[model samples]
Target: MENKGNSESTTTTTTTTSTAPSTESIGVAKDGCNSSRILNINVGIMGHVDSGKTSLAKVLSTSLSTAALDKSPASQERGITLDLGFSSFNVDVASHPLLSQRSEIANHYDRVQFTLVDCPGHASLIRTIIGGSQIIDMMFLVIDINKGIQTQTAEIDQIPQESRQSKIDTMSTKLRKVLEKTCFSQSPMVSVSANPGVVSEEANVNNNQQQQQQQPLQPSQPIGLNQMIDELCKFIEIPKRDDQGTFLFEFDHCFQIKGQGSVLTGTVLKGSIEINQTVQIPQLNLEKKIKSMQMFHKPVKKVVQGDRAGICVTQLDSKLLERGLLCTPKTVPLLNGAIISIEKVRFYKNLVKTNSHFHVTIGHTTTTAIVTFFGNKILDQSTPTTKEETGSIHQFNEKIEYSFMEYLEPTSLEYPVGSQFALIKFDHPVLCPLESVIIGSKLDVALDTSGCRIAFHGSLLQGIDASNRQILHDTLRIFKTKVKEGAVERVHSEDTLIGKNLFSKQTDLSSFIGNYLFGILLVSLSPLDYYLNLLLKRVDKKTFL
Candidate 1:
């Protein structure tokens, strides 16, 4: 009986223990994690007329329609990207070895990921260039293989340089003010029994000296963010070396509807935007919600960097949003007046076209300004040109010029225009700083050694497409001469160029594109890449003229 009772008691105890959950038990867990963090980076392509800015972007973006089949008849007929187009392409972070590491991807993801913003190269759309530039992460800085650097190129490059420098200066000033206060408070102190003022002065000087000695020689080190910014700002002529997080792009077109509300179209330069995300109109300080987005007439849940999508906004009218007005995120940094350093600025036609004043096109808007020589004295107010004048003052009706250049995003503010840079201040606040530039002819300014070399080589190999073997053959010849050292040859061996088959020599392309398409075809029969590859192969097989 005792043995039977023990067995029953043990079984009951075991059952109770198994049935009851432990106090430490958390719950069933999930394997995968979802992230709210997003990288929004904007890229812009600027080049002189017929430089293939549109062609380059068309091939890069996954969303935008190609030039041959684009909906607007004007775009197809004119062979130009009318207005502005926005598009997004996915970049695999793992494919790039540098970005594969956890720490690097976490830190330098924006620089590595590619998103392109396409802008019109015509001189008339300077306003659009400025406005569009505000949201970009880096610039492609495209030059037509044929046209080395033109007047438009100088103007385009100048705007971003000026805008970036201005922002750095503004941030630096703020930081310096903060540092001055901290430095004053942190200085060593001395107390004297008699003659307090005398002792204080002497002590203060000594304390300052001691403090200076204790401080690091490199001011680049941050006592705090403000102090670092202040030190950074002191380099008035240089571009700050810093990385910007988040993506933004500015739109050039705005239209209103009776029932549909306000709509705008352009590329997003920096950060991703979601439906219902509050968007700010910087020019007017008005905010609106992103009601809906349409990319190639299809709806998407969210739009991020490099996306060319049309946004329908709530609670805003077309009248409030104009051509030059900035369409940006509600919470982004406000870029304003810039004191920019410029490098290359040219004349409208030739270097000596005194009578020909050039129009500066930034973003989708254009402004008329007088062309003045680089070294000429800038008049404080608007002045008229003369027949025999060497330099002329060009003024716009509104203060749009200044604002466009200074409103560049913080990441890409490089040095000024000339080797001996010039400092220029815009008349008003530009909503988009990155896109603003000083417009002049391409021949006026002297090119830097590196820039000259690039120009010379590019000039030699104009009209050479990457797909053409003849172009590659010519490029190989130029490469041999320009790159004197044997080092370039080794680098060239590893260098991979994009192929015409869309199957660029990249492993990712072969794997993701080729293999993935094959797998999908087993189930679906037709995929975009499969058809594209088939078409490219057929084109390659054909005989040329």
Candidate 2:
């Protein structure tokens, strides 16, 4: 069967010219090797299923990895990306108008490598899409030029060729409006066609037949590719990197090589790693020495934060690992539960109730957790109206007094403003670093529903180990209020009074004695089980009764 949804092939052309360097020299490594620095930035391609996301990635990429472009048999058979696909292309730093102006960067860096992360857009693969989003520095929301934005694009009457450009602009405007409620509100939208000349139904049929036969087909010239590249370089900002911090790597693909042991492909999240360096997989509690490392098939001595690379390690079973973290020994903690700073997604219409189960995604892992809502009195009084105010208020502080909440009020109500928090008890232990972003979703919600599945997003304030739960409880002041009512039976003496139904048989009378109750001092408790005598001081007997 032909996979009509597979992206058409494209040919990219590049030209190189040699030039003599000026007096300012590029940095060199200790070994005296000329180190031409290449900065890597991850860009995610996302949209609804069959929205031409994979097609766009294919057209832009110059180098493809083993995991790139629906390489899986299942994905190819389904004609959609089933997992994350990785590919990349390099752009000259001096070619960009903005980047060339920065003498400091242009002097040190030779090129910028844009790693395209192709995320599956199918509803059933939303978890995979979310995992892919975590690693990307930016995103491309692709829309099928013919059909525009859709949950799943179906066969429709083709639009007249003359009106296609106008349609693309209209779709871009609609996409911007939809993104206004999200963090990507300021993101730019670009219009491009990966396969510009394959618009006729007969050509599509022929391409599908060729794909079914597993034959390589000639690519049509792409449209707006240069413009897209220009837009990318202009808007892209180099993110701050922490190469000196603890080493952390998130592996999304692992496979065994017959004689080379196993190779793990992933992005470096923090710090740096070198060949022969020891790294531990905390989830499996396994440690292995890095036998070799490669960045897009080029051997590299070291890889720093934000770089996409594949590490080969000996004496490790690749089948035993799929997706997890590799970090410096003992760097990531195993969390049984966690207290997180939370904010409701305004688009989510449902109430977040206490003890409710949610699919909590931390880093690339998604696991079920029971959520308990809590907040300080400050939240009850006022709500933050803007992102700036919300960030300032919702920060977790142990000194702030908090009370248990039955449920988080919907955004429709004015009460759910200000700082909100949640104690998440995970069903399974997760290896997570401190301050990691946590996303809560109701994944069980029907995919057909128009409502947003993402209920909330937050950051981990504190992690709770199974053994250290008590310490957290004692450290944070979370209290519940209780009230009791009773009638004064009669005046027992000049300084005392008898109260009835005040203490139940199960109630600890001694606890009430010497304690303040509704501003009245409970001086003592009587021996009688059904009645208790309260010793009142500095009060008339008639008034006390």
Candidate 3:
């Protein structure tokens, strides 16, 4: 990959390489200028209203001549970056022991690229933030000095833990299956242990405790933050390949330390940050050195992703550092504008009467921008065929009227918001690559049963010739079909079986994912189970080649 940088422009060269390493490489032409390799780091800049995310993004990107902020004038006039901004700065990865071995590592720091993302800072846009946060490396929460840990902050605290747990649970289950298979291969006749099924048992018990904890412990109960953070660490995925991985930096606050002029505090999401490392704030034209660092209160030689650290920088002042600005090593690409493919969104109410400016939050960062819904158009309260510039437009043009609001207008304020009516194309790019996509529906249990049946049948039809695939796929499909048909058919077949009696037993996606994984694990461990081996042989006869 070759990249060129000039006073006015910078270009990046990226290619997906095969497993084999090639001599073809990205080179820089600028003499004396150090070549920097871009590191992928997803940093979510978040804060309350007026926390200075736009100010910070400008300073960070201006140094590079191109930043996301440059694309929109609305950001400058409002003094608020209403859309998520992306800018890359090079950071020195040489200090990282793993990266130092690469000859090109040192050259990469001079142009350390940081993707500057600005998110909406209000509570209304939390869902938008969550959508991006699921994909990013880490989150940078900007805490306003005047107001510490606002309601938004408190709300965010629960999210990291919840998401972390879900990931951990998912990973743990996967790991357990792998281990179980390995063990079965080693010992062919091992008995299935249900007695304190170590991992599974602990998870079950802990899950109960977690449910209790979520409900709010007794006032006297000992709930520790460290314990929660420690639990979160188990799920946090670290880059295994070392070089081509991502890191996260959650900037909680920016301030002027007594001795050091400008400083920031946040936890590194994945990679490491070292002293004297140059950090770039693109909009500020400020490239500063880390004078010192401290993690978990103790002064440390360096900090890595996941470690909360306090950083003191040279040159930039506290005022110059804003909420959304990210200080990154030069080798990473600044998240510029992204052409996101978004599934459609349908509003539930009359959005023309409400606020025109809909908020977009990516990770912890917040921005307010126009959400143009692609697809169909609907009528307003006046039932006018004319289009209004009030809210995001939908795909449908027919004035279809339905009572009982189920969808939300892009302009209408709603929670747990989602859409499927059309594709959404952001006017400006946000941090993540893909737009929020809604899968499945939230209909009644009866509908869920039928939906699962439909999903499973679709999967089965796609794999009719393959025996194993057929069995597995057919089993799932049949399971759902049975559930739905039984509930409905049984209601009349056996007067004893009532729809109301079977209403609460609907299966959802979670069950689907779990069951699918469990089936995979059983097949992977077939050598240990004679019954499974026999099952496989029979199923393989019908496999689709």
Candidate 4:
């Protein structure tokens, strides 16, 4: 009886141990390797079409996501990136000279994961590039050494071996000139050949047997890759992260597994998310709890701001969500219109006028919006300052009064002369949060033109939801001045004068009382008598007649 009891106890103990979750299952081992914290930095790879952006991403990345390297059939067939591609590589924090110098960073982080965002370079796909640019911490403006600057170099070094150095220098100088007036003026430039001198398999097979035997084939290797990585490490700065704020994830891709559920792959724009937490898809008005989460294929219990992650949620239809926001319940508002603080892009030379339509891109969504320009009356009346003397405009202040502008005049390229605001009415409702970045562009322009299509960029100062749009227009203090001219036809009395063509019969003349016309104060106005009978405050009959 004692031997049987001992055997049962042993079996029960083994069963309990087997069922217990391991450290890796709970994500204690960071990145499934060690307990070191992994810091993620997003690097955007941007350039003109056929500029080797994808090749660079492929050579630098150690781990590829499901959507990386132009996996789409359309992309492979067309031989151009149709959408954004994502891939990543791990860098040793201790080994990096610049990162290791920072004691706090080196002590806290064991590895730095660089998530490369490969954006489409086609002119028609500029909208996608604009969306991808918003999420990047740093940018790589690749250039094809053979072809100097092109339309989309916003911001490659695949060149001949003999003249590679000279070509790189020339391209770098030209790039500096192009970026001199832009935000990326001081960004470093690196030259590299992602794929160097490799014959296709068909070409190798077609070679004669004697020639092949004389010259053995060798595998092609990337040139100057280490130098590019070094430049990136030195130029990248740790951006400020807000993990305590409300969780907001902007997903660019969505798909479903057989039984696991739907997976949302995107960068965490702000705050943090964890497994089993309930999240809301505000666009669809659907809520689902997170079943699991992964960062670069390694399971993690939590992901914070700036971290690229894949979140799995059950019972959610992947078809319903292509690219949109997922956040804490009731966090994002559905907006029909917005008031934004706008500044003209220096490269755009076209006039920005009121009532004009622009392609307004907010987050990953691009839609048409009609713009109405407004500025402070005092500032508009003041003497215009030179571009060099101007300063940045402050954000929209509700306490100050503003006057309607017919159009926006050219201002300093470096800074705005005064505070400017635009009332943007969207053609359709957009799901976005307040204070989101807004970019307005004229997308209908000819793509072949050698000019910038981006007109202006700013941040949302106020969001007008569908239900409160009318209330906002009535409450906001944006005014317009009007002038009415007329000649007196006759005089009825010393205090009254009859004028023609001043006010129509349908016009409400009650609001015109106490207004001045021809240096005479109007006490009252009656529009029902086929003309305006303006009752003067104090005037003689002879003065009017």
Candidate 5:
């Protein structure tokens, strides 16, 4: 009788436990784990122009009507990526070693979507490259192993072979170190033929069959598309997402959708946006509510960090929106007049001057800013607690770790310092981890390196907000009030900050000297005033008498 009772009790307990909900179902839905998390990464393919940028991106096109190069009719004839191209493909997680041991899809085979950014390698389109870099996680520096180095701006044959080769080697070393310091320990470098001919999947299969019939192939031979894909996955690291933070989405493409108003798509760099939620375009100062949202071209309830999503917004026209803008949550405010620090790559030729002007590219938004001499400290130096407590302030070209402050209004305060490197493209800043530079310019000419059409990359140190206390408070003061349509349209223009002394390319020393000399001339000529001289003479005669 005792054994029977024990068995019956145990069976009942087991049944109750099996019926209980699993902890894994916390954020998941009845359908599946799609809503729990997204597996997507943004990758940038960078190199000199004509280094097979668009061709490489096309190699990874997701579909037939892909977002590849030659979007412009002119570029089609030229065979170069004129502006910028974006394409994505699904990569099986089974191909790369999974870094996370506790991934939800460990047991099941999962696919990770990679969004490829194809930047124009031409110097003329460096601005576009800078904008694209702001939203990518990693980069593939493509170089032609057969050709020395070629870009539209560079004439490699004109320069001495040995000298050019040595300089290229030096610049490359510096870029690789910067990439390792900023992006990850490994910077993926791929060497290809001068002109890599494209082969279709069908062709590849037939070639494989023929090869098998002909002879046995060596395992180490690197003569296929699989080898290229493997190199990309070899050292790629997944960046952590901030789902709990305020929602921020960088919009690179916007188009009109039939029956759905305007549809905007880009990578979600932070937080989450759901249908019916209100979002703000901080740059445009436009407030909008999310009418509908789609992920992977299907309607989804929400779009989380790292997922490439398209949002259909109501009460707004498609004509008003463009690239280099963002959708942020209405609850959290965007950055205004923040003082960020920067660390340039080791071989970055142009040294920054105080109040020196730079074109900053932060997450696709480009703006002009001036550099200030904050103090001499390494990496990100902390501000002093009190007036007497003098802490270190870093400047440009200082210590391997130096602290310099950059005062730019309307900057994104999402990323942590040293986490993303900033790329300067013809006075534009792009987001980063450090990497190499390959230039075909002459080494002897101490050319004003600033104007050179080359991608200059550096680490962005954590910035201290030097916003006008009164202005910041005033901004919040207005936010506390009820917001209506077109309420906060002038935030950026209101506090736009070019420092007081930023007359660039050359100093205002001549002007200052001229002004001083004019003052002296006025003082000397004032004593010669006829009436004033007579009065002074009379006073002097009276004193002498």
Candidate 6:
């Protein structure tokens, strides 16, 4: 895991090891000088299992001279990325003397650093993949060129339709159908074989180090690897970060590094944390002081927003601080928001109903959230500046609400995310960013049903307590009373008038019928006594005659 840095060019290293690859060589190389600042953008590689996302990430890292970050023991054993892996490389196309004179490249593409995030592609590890995707600026979807797209691309409708002539009509061209309601809906894609024969010499393989092991792979050049890198560098736009907001950091991995004590490695999500600064671990409910900090493997006084770095902290067990933990300033209070209201929710199919459950991914963490409310939500619509973003205390306007008739029913599938919003309530409290909620449904449910699997995605505007539901109901009633009072009054008056007229027109005929029926069927009055007298009289008369 050795990486070298130079004043002129960036260098990367690669090898098979137990430790994660350190991107020490990527920083100063990006700027080509000590004074300039390099822009760092996070990119994630995502696709179905065995789509070669890990290999592609390694190839990109090798091309850039930074060590590839794929050192999971289980992943090495299984030959697949089972967890989130990170690799970074500098791409300063304009830094080269030949391109520096060009206005376009110098103005925009100069000194850009990319943190390549390689996420696991297994369907079972979808949550991990989601966790990876949440942090990245954009996604690079990898698909097997030979296989085209796999089953997870779309829920192939086995139910025969009039449009399809055969029972097994799987059009690979229609794989794009799954994109409409996904977080990666409009993402860029690359196609390669699961075991692409072209493995660059620099791009080392896991090797046949286990049972039935084979010889190490020959150092062959990747076919489309360079072209992919060029396109990525050109396509990926710089992401805006909160350097002035709350001092927040989302650590994906934390472990003891022998002499380093406890090292937490992750990209800085917002604001800045200086050396010796104490940061609060929301999940642990404790504040720990930063003993030391390093960015790009170099010691720094402070780590600013959007930079990837590792920090050694005091008074904390590294094992306990894994992915999904947030380190923020003690001044910022952790929000207890279980009920999140979402807007701009885009669903693939079917109207999202209240009380329905869907998977929610927020900042490299995934969980289930129940649909608490749905409808056209009216919010303040005011964007938050950096100063107001930290430990945000949202004072929602009392008039703001999901108007009555906001529910999305089966009959109203026309309304989508932006047109209508949803209020999702998670099972437990979540620390979601200002706007980072992604919602999607599992495809298994649609296997027997008709339509797409993705449900909806939206950001958390604000949260509400379940206890406030009665107040909302009362407000809705008041609004309805004011808006449609005349219509309601007319219907009530008409109903009362009709009831009075019907009762007045009818007469009582029960007494006469009861008297008549009693004379005929009374056993003690006529039928039983007449039969007994007739039997005795007939027998006596016959004998007398």
**Each candidate's TM vs. the true structure?**
0.36, 0.78, 0.30, 0.77, 0.54, 0.64
Candidate 5, residue 231: Cα displacement in angstroms equals: 2.9
Clashing pairs in 2: none
List model 4 lDDT by residue over 1-545, tens digit each: 00000000010000000011222221122234474477788988877777667777776676788799999999999878999999987777766666788776787888778899999989999989999999988777665555556665421222234565665666567666866775566665555555455333232444455322222244355555565666666666778988897999999999999889999999999899899899999988998999999887888899998989999999888998889998999999988899988777767888889999999999899999999998854334454444344554466777777888887655543224556789999999888777799999999998878989999888888899867888887778888988776656776654666778876789887787656554443445556322333344344333422
Tell me the lDDT of candidate 2. 0.72
lDDT of 2 by residue, 136-233 (tens): 88766665555444556544233434676666566556655766676666655555556543333233356456422223234345555665666676
What is the TM-score of candidate 1?
A: 0.36
Please give the range of 10 consecutive residues that has the lowest summed lDDT in model 5.
1-10
Cα lDDT tens digits, model 3, 1-545, are 00000000111010110121111111111222334233434445555645444433433332221225535576567554454445433234443333344445444433333344556654444443443443345444333322332343322122222243344344334333533533222211101000100111122356456433233222221112122222222222333323123333555457775765676765464456677767765445457777888632346666664344567776666775445434464422323222121221231222321113333444344444332222223333333321243234233322332222222234222211111132122335333312222221111223212111100000000111223433433332111112322221222221121223322456443543322111212325434455544444444333211
List runs of model 1 lying over 4 Å from the truth. Answer: 1-38, 46-53, 65-70, 95-98, 101-103, 106-113, 121-135, 139-249, 255-260, 266-311, 315-322, 326-365, 369-545
Each model's lDDT comes to 0.37, 0.72, 0.35, 0.72, 0.45, 0.51
Candidate 4 lDDT score at position 401: 79
Q: Alpha carbon lDDT of residue 461, candidate 6?
A: 62
TM-score of candidate 5 versus the correct structure, residues matched by position: 0.54
> lDDT of candidate 5 vs native?
0.45
How badly does each model clash, as a count of residue pairs? 60, 0, 77, 1, 20, 4
lDDT of 1 by residue, 326-431 (tens): 3454443333222222333211222223223333334444333332222222333332222133142232211222222211111111321111111222233334
- Candidate ranking (lDDT, best to worst): 4, 2, 6, 5, 1, 3
TM-score ranking from best candidate downward:
2, 4, 6, 5, 1, 3
By TM-score, who's the top model here? 2
For candidate 1, the per-residue lDDT at 54 reads: 53
Over 8-118, each residue of candidate 5 has an lDDT whose tens digit, in order, gives: 001000000001122122111122234334456677777665545555455455431124556867888886787657666655553344423425544433555667777
